[model samples]
Target: MQETPLCLRVGHFLPYSMSDLNTTDFTNPSTFILVGIPGLEAAHIWISIPFCAMYVIAVLGNFSILFIVRREPSLHGPMFYFLCMLAVTDLVMSTTTIPKMLSIFWFNSREISFSACLTQMYFIHCFSTMESGILVAMAFDRYVAICNPRRHSTILTNSVVAKIGLAVVLRSGILALPYPFLTRRWPYCRTNIIPHFCCGHIAVVKLACADIRINSYYGQFDLFSVIGMDVFFIAMSYTQILRAIFCLPTKDARLKTFGTCISHVCTILVLYIPELFFSLMYRFGHNVPLHFLVLIPSVFHPVPPVLHPIIYGVRTKQIRGRLLQLFTHKEI
Candidate 1:
C-alpha cells in the first residue's frame, strides 16, 4: 500500500482535517446568516410588500407628528412634548430593524458580520426598553393630569419632562449595554445561522456552544425589572385615573375626563399586548409551530410603530385639526 500522507495520518487521529481547521474558525465566526422565516421562505417577497408599506406609513406618520408638534405653538404642552418623544422612539425602533429585514426579503443579502449583528442587537433592545419607559412616563402624565389636576403643570414642568426623558434614555442604554458584551464573549462553535430576521438577543445567544445560563438568567432579570416595573406603575396610575373619572359629578364630565385617556390607553395596549405574547411564546412555546414563532416577532416589531401615530392623530383633537389644515391648506 502507498504511504499515507502526514496530513491524512494526523486527520485520522483528529476530529477535523488540517484543511478544515485552517478554513473554519469555530471560536469566532466571521459572519452570520439571517433567515426571514424558516418555513415561509417562499413567500418572502410577498410578505415584504406589506412590511414595506407599513414602514413607509410609519415613517410618514411619525415625521408628521414631529413636524406638527414642533410647528404648532398650541401643542407645546407637557403632553405634546411627551408625544414628540414617543414619536422619536417609534421612528428609531422601526428604522433599526425594518430596512435590514426588507433587504433580506428583497435581495437575499442575509450575511451580517459579527460586530454589525451585535450593533443591531443593541439598538433593537435599547429602544424597546426606552419605549417601555416612555410609556410609563406617559401613564404618569395622565395620572397627574386627571388625579391631581391642580399640580399637573407644576409637577410635570418643562424641566421635569426633560429629566424624565433623560432618565428613560439612561435606563434603556444601561440595561441594553450588557447584551452585546455578553453575546460577544461566547465561542460560536455551533452554526451561525439565526432563524429570525433581526439579531434578537436570545436567538443569537442560542448559537453559542458555551453554557448560556448566565445569559438566560440575566435576560429574564432585565425583562422583568424593566417591563414588569413599568406595567405595575402604569396600572397604578390608570387605577387612580379611573377612580377620579368615576368621582366626577356629571356624565359629560366623566366622558370628557376618560376621553383624554383613550389615546394613551390604546397606545399602551398596542405596545404591550403583542410584546407580552412574543415574550410568552419565546419562554413557554416549545411545542409552538415554527411559523408562529417567526410570525409573532415579525408582526410584533412593526405593528406598534404603525399604529401608535395613527392612534394619536385620530384620537387627539389638536393633532387631527393640524393634520386637516396640513392636507386642506386651510384652517380646520
Candidate 2:
C-alpha cells in the first residue's frame, strides 16, 4: 500500500487519504507518520492526570448506582431497569477509550494496529448507539408514567421491558456491525496514528486508500439517523409529558409527576446536548479544534451515568431510604 500524497492541507491537520480507505485493503504501507494534536507533550501533562481521575470516579459512580438498584427491591421497575442498562452502557463507554487514552498520554505511545483500531471503533459506535436507544426507551417509559399512569404497569411489564432491552441491544449491534466491516475492508495507505484516543470513524476512515464514498455516506447517514431519530422521539415524548403536566387537574399530581421525571430530564439533556453539538460540529464545523472536539464528548460521556444513580436515589425517597438501610445493615 502506497501512502496518499498530501495534496492540500486543512488547517494544520492533514487528512491521511482523501481517496478511498476501507477494510478490504490488506497491504501495509512502509511509512507510518504521526499526526494529530500539535503539542502532545503539553497535552499529556495538562490533560492526562485529570482525565485519569475522572475515569476512576466514573467507574465507581456507575458501579455504585448499579449496586443500589440491584439490592433495593423497591427500586425494581421500568425506570430502574432502564437506569441499570444505562449504567452498563456508561461502564462500557468510559472503559472503551479512557484507559488507552491515559496510556498514550502518559507514555507518549500513539501507535495502534489496524485490527485494534477497528475493534475500538466498533465498540465506540456500538455503545454510542446503545446509549441513544436506551434514552429513547426511557422517554417512552416516562411518557407512560405521566400521561397514562393508570396503565403504566400493564403497558411496561417485565416481558415488555425485556423486549425493549433486547431490541435496543440488537438494533445497536446491527447498526454498528457495518462500521467494522467498512473499516476492515479499506486498505491502509497512510500512517495509523489516530488523532483522538480511540479509533473514531472520522479518524480511521480518513486513512483509506480505496474509494470511501460508500463508507462515508453510510457513516454520516448512520450518525444522523440514529442520533436524529432518537432525539426527535425523546423530544416528542417530553413535549407530551409537559403538556400533560400542565393539564393535570390537581397541582400536587402535576408536581409529583414532574418531580419523578426531574432526574431523567437532567440526564437526558446532559447526555444529548454534547452529542448533538458533536454531531453538528463534525458534520459542518471544519475549524473545530481536535482537542475541543474530543474534550466535549469525553467530559459528557462519563457524567450522565455517574450522576444518574445519585440523582435518582437521593430524589426518590423510597429508593434513598432502602439504599441507606442497605448501608447501615452492612456496617452493622
In candidate 1, how many Å is residue 215 off? Answer: 0.9
Query: What is the per-residue lDDT of model 2 for residues 169-287, given as tens digits with 9 covering 90 to 100?
Result: 99999999999788777767444444555677766666677777777788888988998899899989999999999998899988988998888787777777777777677555656
Looking at model 2, residue 168 earns an lDDT score of 98
Once model 1 is optimally superposed onto the true structure by TM-score, how far is the C-alpha of residue 238 displaced, in angstroms? 1.1
RMSD of 2: 4.8
lDDT of each residue in 1-332, candidate 1, tens digit only:
11122112223332223344322447777887776676676788999998999999999999999999999999988899888988898999999889999998899887789999999999988999999999999999999999999999899999999999999999999999999999999887646667678898887887777787788888889888888999999999999999999999999999999999999999889988888778767755766765677776897689888998899999999999999999999977
Compare the candidates by TM-score and give the number of the best one.
1
RMSD of each: 7.4, 4.8
**CA displacement after TM-score superposition, residue 53 of candidate 1 (Å):** 0.6
| Poorest 10 consecutive residues by lDDT, candidate 1 | 1-10
TM-score of every model?
A: 0.92, 0.84
